[model samples]
Every structure is written in structure tokens, then in C-alpha cells.
Target: MATQEEHPLIAEYRRFSPGSETLAERSTAVFPGGDTRSSAHYGPYPLVMDHGSGCHITDVDGHELLDFMNNFTSLIHGHAHPAVVAAVKEQASKGSAYAATSLNQIELAELIVERVPSIEQLRFTSSGTEGTLMAIRCARAATGRQKIMKMEGGYHGSYELAEVSLVPDPNERGSLDAPVSLPIDKSFPESVLRDTVICPYNEPERAEALIDTHAQDVAAVIVEPVLGSMGMLPASHEFLAALRRATERHGIVLIFDEVITLRLGDGGAQSVYGVIPDLTCMGKIIGGGLPVGGVGGKRELMQLFSPSQENPVMHASTFSGNALTMAAGKAAMEAYTGDEVKRINALGERLREGCNHAFQQAGIKGQALGMGSLTNLHIASNGVLHDARDSIAGMIAAGHIPRLLHLCMLRRGVASASRLMFCVSTAMGESEIEQAITALHESLAELGPYVASERPLLVA
Candidate 1:
């Protein structure tokens, strides 16, 4: 009997990065799934990154790719920025971390508090997962409520509650008016599903009703202004405004998980939408490409974590405000001025427009969805995506075509998330944006035959 043949695209990818393929095999001896980080993993295998500088990275095979993924959007200034490098090095000479607060830590916090509209005070954590976890705990402690209201398909962090209904399986997700809380994996406990109230994304009325229904027990309503893992779907102002009104009327804490969306503006999505959240969970770029997280809010709500207060929320982490990360973060934030944000945001718009044109030129059904400096490609012709379900439908129809397109793009020297998510960084200029657009066009041309043969429905 003959063995099943590998897809031509996967075979091409394997050929293009044979060095990475060899390293991936070696990595499996120590790291599970041939990788330590699950989000960064892909098949036939992910590239073995040799080094990165500015907005470009070279794989072990000596192939250079424009770094659009930017380490899952954490490297806002791009890899090994001079300012960030200098700060990290300067701090390293002093010490990496300490048991006490560092000047950089205090300065970074002050900067965040001054910029973000919702964050009056904040406490750092080692990762975004911890940030959201502490935010939930803070709300529960403040409200004495047991339940948390999170949007369907909204991802806060790695925890059970934050990830409840993250994937939104169409079969089990129930009606849009009343989205049932379904776990992305089997690890979720029944109580977590019960404790989490799932509100449909972008449906203002439905979300308002859900909040009203669970007002008594709901401690907080946590949402992302632009749903990150859900194809970068931006929440409508009406939807976010509705949530704010509903949560306020119920006296429930309103938390904005701006972990990915913080780069959208000087004060994040809150300032852009003019919808103030009671609490905000942040990470990603704020850490200056290091591990970090933070939960901040109105002084009254944030005071819960104050050690000076009675029975404080018990916030403590070994590396929360370590000197090295703080120095790097401070330098990153300082370099990421308001003008740089605007410039990168314009590049994002240009990329999206160019991508949409490429899909049309290739006669493939697809579009780019996102806000400001963040963007995601979906294999759908849908005009405006309001929620995850809309994006998922396209993913289902395209089958393996999107993955094929990703591999093709990589061969063309552009790197994005395996899911086709792209982001613009300060290090990227108009030229880099154009380079990625050209790569996308070429990749789409390569995949046109596959779409027409295997996924005809995706043909424009």
C-alpha cells in the first residue's frame, strides 16, 4: 500500500526551511510538540529563528522574512530596538531583578496611569494571564459576587474563566441571543462554565439582556474592544457603550482586557471608543518584549489591592516589577510616542487595503479585519465582520486553504501568525508594509489553484 502524500504546499514549506525542520526534530526530544510555546507552533514545522533586528528576522536557513507577527504583537518597537536594548543592558549591569521596587517600574507605571483613561492605579503581574486573574479576583472581592460575565469568543488570558467560550463551537455555542458558555478544551470544570455568563460578541441588545439576567451574581463584565483571538473583530462603539451602561446599572465592575488592543491609541481602546471601563487588564507591548502584566482602574477599585488597606487582595509576584523588564518597558513606552502610533496605524490601514486588493486580484474570497496597528486576514469576502461566528464561517468554508496561504506567504519572505494575523510595528515603515503586500499577492497567486480545486466556494 502507498503512503498518503503530503500536500504540495506543506512539501514546499518543508523544502524552504529544511534547517528548521531538522531543528524541530531535535526540539521534540526536550520540548513537547517540537515547541515550548503553543501559540507560536505550526506544521510541517515552525522556523528556527536565528536572530531578529528592526522589523526583520532571519531563519536558520538564512532566509529573511519581514516580521509582521512581531512575536504575537508584543514587539511594538520590533525586535532588539536600540533604545530597548540599551535600557535592558544598562539595567542588566545593575541587576536583573530585585525583591524591592525599581525606579523604572515606578516610572513605567506612572506613564501607563497617565495615558490610559481607565487606569488610575495599577499592580503589575508576571504575565497577562495573572493580570486578568487578579482583576477577576479583585472584582469578586469588591462586589462579593460569584459570577463573571465575559463575551463569547473573547480571550482574556490562559485561565479557565478568561478562556470560557473562547472558540465558540457553532454546534454547542447555542443561540446568539443567549450564547452558552462552552470551554475551548476539556480542562474546564463544570463550575467554571456555570460561573461564566457568555454574551454574544457585538450584539449590544443581547449583551445588555444577558448582563441584566445575571446582574445579581455577576461580579464583572470583561471584554476586549477588539477580540484578538477571534480574528481581530472590533467591537462597535454601540456594543461597548451598551455594556458600560448595563454593567454600571447593575453595579458590576466593567473590565477591558486591552492586552492586545492597548497599542490602538495612547490610552488604548477606552480612549478611542470613549467608553471608560472600571478596570483594565494589560500586557504585551507594555513589557518591552518581556514577560509582564498589569491590572489598573479607578482609584477606588484599585485600592482593593493596596497593602495599606484592610484585608488587601493579596497581590504578590516574584517578577512582577523586576528591574530589567521595567527598564526595557520604560524605554519601549517612551520610544513609542503618539506620532509613532499614528504612523504604524496608517501602515496597518495600507496593508489591509493592499491585502483586500490582492484577494480580489487573485479571485479569492477574503478580507482583512482589525483596528489601528493590529490586523488579521480572514478567508472571507464578508464586508464587515461583527463577531467571531462570522469569521469562523469563512474559516470553515476555506478548509485548509488559509493554512496553505500562510505557508505560501512564508516562502515569499513574509511572516505572520499561522492564523494569518498581521500587525504593524514602529520599526516598520511604508516600504515594509508594501513588501508584505507584495508577498501576500504572490502567496495568493500560488494558492489560487488550490482554492479553485479543493475549495471552489472560496473563489471570487
Candidate 2:
């Protein structure tokens, strides 16, 4: 167990991040929990970042760390890439937002449509949240169905509809074959819960069965190719194929929420998997580290939004395709070619291998699981996890090990999500990968005795 001196997690957090402590305390007066994003918070506080350049972030305390967070995987090229900076600066001088369309927006859309084969046409929104919402609404409008089928523990966004059945309690999650649709919060209306059908992840037979059962009422089945918020769990090819077959057979729209997974490859996870959806929701890196979202698919489906006459689904955002974001996005996308994608993915593989080797060498039972350029560390003796329930159980059994390990990595000049998922960027090289591996070695050493004592199950 952690010694009495280290029992107070908050104290250790403050000792490592004193500046963040002060900043968090001050910010709490305005923002809830001293932070705006719920996913970014830590035990005591988060590092108050001043600025970032390339793959490094300098915090207010003058600590420079390799930025694996990458603004939640949005900055594929990392911070302040010269091309993106030039584009943003140039666009800023011209104008920021205008209700009218601009050439920059058209150019950006053209690039996206050209790269992603599924996207014959596209429309932009202000966020991934809005992108998923718009896709769901479009599906509903086209099919005239009400209910939506989402994977159990799949997170689309913050909205009530997208968040249905996100964090099911262990006891109430129901059988693996027949998952229950549980509300994420009380704010979700009973009708919303009723309108959602939860399917177990990576379970092809169960997914097909559930889709078949709910086919009459379900307008769409939305899923992340790689479950982002739930420990970077990648869906099996069989499961995704099953969804495609079932959705097609049932006349339901299949929507792949590639908001995070878009960074995986040239055509996104859909391209990698060779299974295209009826509608694709995208965000994150596509905007060049700015706020942007898009839904694209076959022209027949996407044309539902045609403003030529009465658009079926009403969609408009004041900043949907603002000039600045378009400029930056175009620059960023231009820089990211097939070669760049392969390089970053190779880096991610190296990171995973190094972390896994470290765990094995330390006689700790854990696994680094993910795909392409993203990876997540889960402390479990059960090997790689297939779904969110497995991830949640691993986290609960590991106690505070992952959290402490995260803090330990930060102190060692490495930064990742609090959950320990690290993403590789174009800015990172062999040196960054080695540094991350060394940090993992050091962090596991620091927490070794505690896991051996209190969490023997993790090391068993």
C-alpha cells in the first residue's frame, strides 16, 4: 500500500504541481472544480499550461513536458506548427467569422471530401458533439424512426441523447448478451432512455441480435470505431461488420462517430476497416486544433441537408466553417499525408511495446491497448480489455495506481490523459518515445511497492 506519508493523494498532487494548485483554487471561483472539461481534472489540480510548441508544453511552474495529451488528440501536428500558425495568422488578419460562405470553407470541405471516400458531400458544425447530434438527427429525419442504438459505454458527446447508457453501474449493466439502456445522469429524460438501446461492444452476435430486436424503432446505430473515452478500446472487425450488415438489412442508418478515430488513417477508421457507414461524424484533428465538426456520407444521405430548397434537417452554426479554422485546417491537412500517418502510427506501436515490456520486466500484470497512433494503459492481470466493463473493472481493481502513475509520469516530464492514454504526434520522434518509455519504467518503480502490497491482484 502507499505509505502513510503518501496516503493523501491530494498532497502528493500539490507537491508535484504547486502552481496548478494555486491556479485551480483561483479558477474554482468561476469554473466548476477549477476546470471546464470534466475529463481533464486530476486529484488535486491539473497543470496550468502556459503554452506549447511542437510536442512540448510548458506549464506555469516552468516545467516542460512532452505533451502526449495533444489537446485531447486534436493537435495531430502538435502545437504551433509553423504552417498552421502562418495560416491562422494570415486568416486572422482577413476576418474570423462571417455568416456568408467563403472560399476557405469550400477548399477545406473539398479536401475532406476528396480524402474520405464515404463523404460524397459534407456539412460543418462547431464541435464533434454537434456533429454526432446532427448525424443522429439526420438519421431520424430520413428514417422517421425515434430510438437510437449505441454501444454500451460508448461516449459520443456531452449531450443527453449522445450520453445515454454511457457509464452503467457494474451490477445494473445486465447480461453481456442483452445490455440495458441506463441513463448517464438524471438530466436524461425517461423518454431519451426509452429511445436508446444499448449494445455490448465487441460482441458481434449480441450486437446483431439487439439490432434485429430494435430494428423497427431504431433510426440509427452510432458507434466509435475505437471507443475513445472508455480506454481506447477498438471494436473488432467482426462487430463492426455485423453492425453494417444489420443496419443495412433493417433500413437503419449506420453512423461511425470518427470524431477521435479520424486521426487513425487517411480515410479514418472506416478506411482502415474497409467498412463504410451511411453517415460519418468527424471532428478533432480535421479542424487543425480548432473547433470544427462534420458529418459526411453518400450524397443521397448527405443531400438531405441540401439548401437548394427545403432542407430536411435544419443545420446552421455561426462559426461552423469560419475562415480562421478553415485556413488552419487546410494547412494541417495538407501537411498530413499517408507517410506522416504511417510514421505516427509506428511511433504509437513503439510506445505500446515499450510500456508492455516495462510492465512485464517489473513483473506487473498490465496491458497497453489501442490502435494506430493511440494507446491506453490498463492495469489488469486479465490481459487486453475488449470493452468498457472490462476497463472499468480494471480501473476499480487497480485502485489509485493508474492515477498515481499518471502523476508520476507528469513529474518525470511526460504528459498523457489522467487515465494514462498517450497519443503520438508528428512532432514526436525516437527521442520522445524513449523518454516516454523511461518515464513508464520510473513511474512503475515508484508505484511498485504499493501495487505489490495493496493491489496484489494487479501483480498476481
Candidate 3:
């Protein structure tokens, strides 16, 4: 099955994406990394977009790819859903922004409150980064505690502390009980590291003990039910429940950063796990495809942001409740009913199963692990995976295969996050899911020789 010994892996990528390379060269003179967004950047370059509709996106090179990436899973209905497009267009025609409250904002908030069990009152933000940031600050203000406990490898946003200890280096990740807060980049301040208490993910007893140990100063325990950036590993029920129990007992706020996992169910992952959080941070589908985010919870915690309060948290964003985003969110939520959510979740399950089968057939050590609508492809030694260490090990073993696999899928008219995370959109069904699976099977086959020649440990 060895194709060509002379051709290198990255050369294959360059061959397939000449347009992206051209665009990257053109972009480098302006943007620092030849791209404005660091998350979207990969080894060679990224596909430049032309337009998208439904689940398909046409690139600048005229390739129509099935968009599994879906703008990092924010496009719940996939690009330009009729209802969302209509709502946004109508709102835009009327007015885009007003530094005051609007009916659309209220309607969108009502829709979110109605579905999410824990969110009684909510505050909108321009981005998920702000949502999580505000949630943490609110927790601190409410509890009067300065420190926050976050799971290792859990990425809440782009901010410093949110990403502290996010990439646990073997050289610096201290111990399992007390993880050293490793900065993702040089910009992270010492103060940000000091305020953070790192907790090992999925280690119930250790995590609970750590949370309890720092209970006095720990303002909040923030976690993602589905670990989005760390290879899409879902937190075990016991771990999340432990955090809830520990935080409750110690007067520490428990926040579910559902920015990604809210799509798991009608009421979010908290509903799925049967554990409630004191505060929930939401993004993605809530805004349809528009840029929006929000933080919400019981009135007690949420009310801290209310103007009626004497000393309210200073949470402000100019476009927080912009008319266009609100209208888009309302329309998106209105069309995304309980039944529709379940349908997409079922489709997600189908996609996962198909991808797993593809890995088996291709003789690769990998698995698709996630819950509900979100899934991530991990090149693991086993079919099962649990924690951050496992995810890191798998990535190390796979080496260039993940990037190569992503490129291979792209060439075959499929699109996924550079990290290989996928979310099912309402625009997708079994056929689209099957196309992705077929693409994966073929991509893995095409990659087999490279895997054997380069990283043979990846073979099952």
C-alpha cells in the first residue's frame, strides 16, 4: 500500500491547496501569522472562504466542501438558514445597534431561559471569551473570593487565565494533585497564574480534594461538560457532579462553560448529566451564526449584574444586546425545537459510529469521542479515551497524521476544524454524515503508508 517514498506528507498538503498557499502569502504582509485568528491557522495554510449555504461551503478555489467545522460549531443550523437569514436581514434593515435594550434581546433571553434549567436571568456578551470572563468575575464578586479552579486542558476562551494551565507541559505541569499553571504563551502575567488553581480533569477524588483545599479562596470551579479544545473529551458525570458537590458545600460557585456543550440537549449538558450549575456560560447556537454569547444562572448570582443592585458587577459590551444578533438568536432558537435537537443528536451518534468503523477498517488506532451533536477525532491507541493526558499522548503518537488527515478530508470535499473536531448541523443528515465517514475511511487509507513509514505506533 506504499504510494510514493519520495513524496513528503506536507508536500501532499501543498499540492492539494495551492490557492490557500497563495492566499497565505498574500495575507502575511498584513496579519502577524498570515491570519487574523490563531485558532484557524495550521501547518501549511487554511482554505479561504467564498460563501456558504446550508451545510456546504464553497472556498475561494471553487471547492464546495461539506462544512463539518461550521465556524467552530457556532453555525448550529449551518450557513445561512432561511429563518436566521431573514431575521438578521429584517433586523439590519430596521437598525443594527442601539446602546440600549431592545425587544429582540428580551425575546432571545426568554427563549434561552425557557430551555436551560439553571438559567433564570442572563446577560449577553459579544463573544464567548467575554461570557466566560464575566461569569468568573461574577462568581468572584458574589463569593468575595479571588481564586478560580479550572480543569487542566479546558479552554474557555482566548484570555490569559482562561487558558492558564491549558497546555500542561511535561516539563512544568507540576503534579496531578496540584497542577502548575502553565501559560499558553509569553503574554500571560504572573498575577493571572497566581489567581488560578489548576485541577486534573476526570480525577474525581483528586479534583474534589483540590477544590475543597482551595475552597476558601477559590471563587469558582469552571468547566466544560464537553472539553472542546482538548480533543473534545467529555467530562465524566462523576467529575462534574463532584465539582458541584464540592463547590456547593464550600460556598464556591460552580460554573458550566456550556459554550460548546449546550447543543448536547434542549437544556444543555447539565440536563443530560442531571447536575445543575450555579452559572452557565453559553455561545455557539444561541446566536445562530452571528457573533454572540451569554452568561446566566439562578437569579441570586445573575442579579449581581443588575443595575438595580447597589454594587453591581461592571459588565459592559457595546454590542452585547445588538438588535441583529438578538433577532438572529431568537429565530435560531425558535426553529431549533426539542425534537429538532434530538434529530441532530441522533445524526451525530450516527456520524461517530461511522467514523469509528472507518478507523477500524483503515487499521488505525483512533476513535470519535463526544456526546450529542459534538464529536472529535482522536488518534488514540485504544477505542476508549478519558482525560487530557490521553489526548496529548494520542496527538503525540499521531504526530503529523492529524494535520495530514484534515487536509486529506478537505481534498475529498469535507471540512473539519484543524484539530479535527466536528459538530452536526441541522443542515446535515445521514447522507452528509456518511460522506464524512467515507472521506475519513479514504483519508486514513491514503495516510496508511505515511503512518507506517513515519509513526508506525499509530497502527492498531
Per-residue CA lDDT of model 3 for 67-167, tens digit only, reads 99999989889999999999999999999999988998998899889989999999999999999999999999999999999988899998998999787
Model 2 lDDT per residue over 385-436, tens place: 8988888888778888888888888999999999888999999998899999
Question: What is the number of residue pairs that collide in model 3?
Answer: 0
Q: In terms of lDDT, which candidate is stronger, 2 or 3?
A: 3
Taken over the whole model, the C-alpha lDDT of each candidate is 0.91, 0.88, 0.89
Candidate 3 Cα lDDT to native: 0.89
Mark the 10 consecutive residues where model 1 has the least summed lDDT: 1-10
| Top lDDT model | 1
The clash numbers for all candidates, in the given order, read 0, 0, 0
Which window of 10 residues has the lowest lDDT sum in candidate 3? 1-10
Q: Which candidate wins on TM-score?
A: 1
- RMSD for each of the candidates: 1.4, 2.0, 2.4
Query: Residue-wise lDDT of candidate 1 within 317-423, one digit each (tens)?
Result: 99998898899999999999999988999999999999988888988899998999899999955577788888777778878888888899999999999999999
Model 1 pairs in collision: none
Candidate with better TM-score, 1 vs 2: 1
